[model samples]
Target: MAYDLEEQEQIDVIKTWWKQNGNTVLLGVAVFVAIVAGIQGWRYYQHQQTTQAAGLYEAFQGAVEKHDVKNVRGIAGQLMEQYPRSAYASRAAFIAARSNYEGGDGKSAKAQFQWVIEHAKSDEIKDAARLQMAGVLLDEKNHEEALKLLDSKHGAGFDGLYADLRGDVLLASGKSDEARAAYQQALEKMDPSGGYRGLVQLKLDGLGG
Candidate 1:
């Protein structure tokens, strides 16, 4: 049907408006689409990383269950190398270190502990690594070095263990007074019902405290 004069004039006005503003509108729409695409792409990348980390963790578990320390170390090394930013990698490094320690390879255990101490995102994990490393160093009679590592800022997370090891080191170094204080501090931080409480108390009494 043919439009009347008013309708014909309205159509001409609409056409003119589109011709003048069309490019800007299309450009705005394109920008919105690109932003949405970027967000989705980032989410997809994160999901992929999570999935890969999970798979690597499962492989580590399998090697552990088989009692294969060598295989565990190899797989855990790959995981840490490729996914160092992942929590799974941190956990894998800890487990691998423990496995190495149990298998009588203190050097590998020390390396793994140092790696976790330096690289873990979680402060709690880093403190735990430091604690273990200190214990190993003490066993090696590197008392001064162990003290330095244990001197790290563990805050409340490792108060008990730090105090206990510090006491041990002091006792070994024949600083009985400082040793007694450290043992007392350890006992105060420990659970009253804990078995270590009695041990600490005994040590304190032996020091004539």
Candidate 2:
């Protein structure tokens, strides 16, 4: 009888403890489940976004190939608006910019290039956009503006190209000595085995360096 009473007393203690802590435990479990669900949902949404963005990019490419400027712009705009952070958006902008430039729409080309420069997540893309924009400015004989774009930050890999463009701008602005220095810098920064090395050397030779 005494042992039965002891067991009953232990059972009562357990019930009291559960009554005090059960609610907290349940709340923790609920929070954990919600967090897991939220993470899974976010991942699924991101995958869907990437798939949609890629589809749009492919459509944009087809439009570009067909010289369908209206469709290209429409698709590119959608990508930029909906998936600005996606890699496809930046690539779309690049393609649009090149097509516009080739089709004699310098204004549109510059706008697209500027968008890439401002919105692209990749440093390489931004540098490339700057270089292309500088080229457009040079074609327009806006030497100072071209130089300004070249003066911005660039990656190490782009140093040679940036210097080359700077040389071209200087040369066009009647600064032969400065242009020679810029060309020499280009040759110094370029990879020894790069095809651009030979081009830079040829330019230097033409400049009597």
Candidate 3:
């Protein structure tokens, strides 16, 4: 509210209020400044974490490309321990999982895949992790566990792969009819233009009528 500067009484009232409340007002200002500084500090810390995690992920990818499975696993473990929530951590885990699997370390591969499935922010990444984990289970000939993993909810785009893997599990379990149905469902889910369609068709043909 505006008052006439000529009002001496209002001026006197303002001076009295300020004398009583000035310290409280100053305290509020100090608190606001501290809060803003704290936010900036936190943001800077997060940026540093992300930058470091990214550098580590680059190193991990390089290791993967060079087929240095030991280095890949080491870097991935560091990321998981130090920056598990960072975006790069999950990606590093994915690469490391593949590396370990190819290196004949199925147990390490499963653990890394589980980490991605549990910690990845993206549903697509989680879906892919589950798919790969199921594949590992299939390789172990743990058909029931593989089927359970394959039957879990996945991304729509993953349906064909899920179904195909499911068919494999069923066939291994000695359920030819269920395997045939799953193979058919895989064909229906797959895109006709996809090169893998021919592979799935071959599987279906191999199953025979």
Candidate 4:
């Protein structure tokens, strides 16, 4: 009777273990399957975006080579709208901005530069956009706006150019003292090995600072 009771107890314990662990095993399988599906889905999305961005990049290059301002602008606009997050889109915006600027469409150039500044995925592109936008503003005699943009923190990489442009705008506005200060700042920031050092020195001489 004791042996029979012991066998019955073993059976009960096995049943309890299965009951507790079976559902957990099933849940684990489900979670693993979900993770695999998510990885595959992400890979597919990356492939699709890469393919689209490549095609757009090729078209953008072709348009640029053709030098057809209208075509370049249209294609760049479409590419940027369709693939805003793509690197190609940021490049296209920069190209389109230059095309528009050369075509005497300052308004469109400003818009394109603004888009690049706000949406570019890279800091280099953002800096380029900011500089170009400030230039356009200065051309349009929006001195205050241009100054604001030039005065923005562009870090060390862009300090020299930013200060130089700020000086130009200040000169245009007849703020000679401010212009001299900005020019001196630009000189201090410039690399001694850079080609612009001579030009900056010329500017300094003109300012008599």
Of 1 and 3, the candidate ranking higher by TM-score: 3
Considering only N, C-alpha and C atoms within 3 Å, which residue pairs clash in candidate 4?
none
Worst 10 residues of 2 by lDDT: 1-10
lDDT (Cα, tens digit) per residue for candidate 1, span 68-89: 8888999889888988888888
Q: Which stretches of candidate 4 lie over 4 Å from their true place?
A: 1-15
- lDDT for 108 in candidate 1 is 95
> RMSDs, each prediction?
2.7, 2.5, 3.2, 3.1
Give the worst 10-residue stretch by lDDT in candidate 3.
1-10
User: For each candidate, what is the lDDT?
Assistant: 0.90, 0.93, 0.92, 0.89
Q: What TM-score does structure 4 among the candidates reach?
A: 0.88
Per-residue lDDT of candidate 2, residues 1-209 (tens digit): 35588899998998999999989999999999999999999999999999999999999989988989889888988888899999999989888888889989999999999999989999999999999999999999999999999999899999999999999999999999999999999999999999978988998899999
Error of 1 at 205 (Å): 3.5
Strongest candidate by TM-score: 3
Give the per-residue lDDT of model 3 (tens digit) for 15-114.
Answer: 9999999999999999999999999999999999999998999898888789887898899999999999997889889988988899899999999999
- By TM-score, highest first, what's the ranking? 3, 4, 2, 1
Stretches > 4 Å off in candidate 1: 1-27
Question: Which candidate wins on lDDT?
Answer: 2
Off by over 4 Å in 3: 1-8
lDDT of 4 by residue, 72-158 (tens): 888888878888888888899998998899889999999999999888989888888898899989899999999988877776889
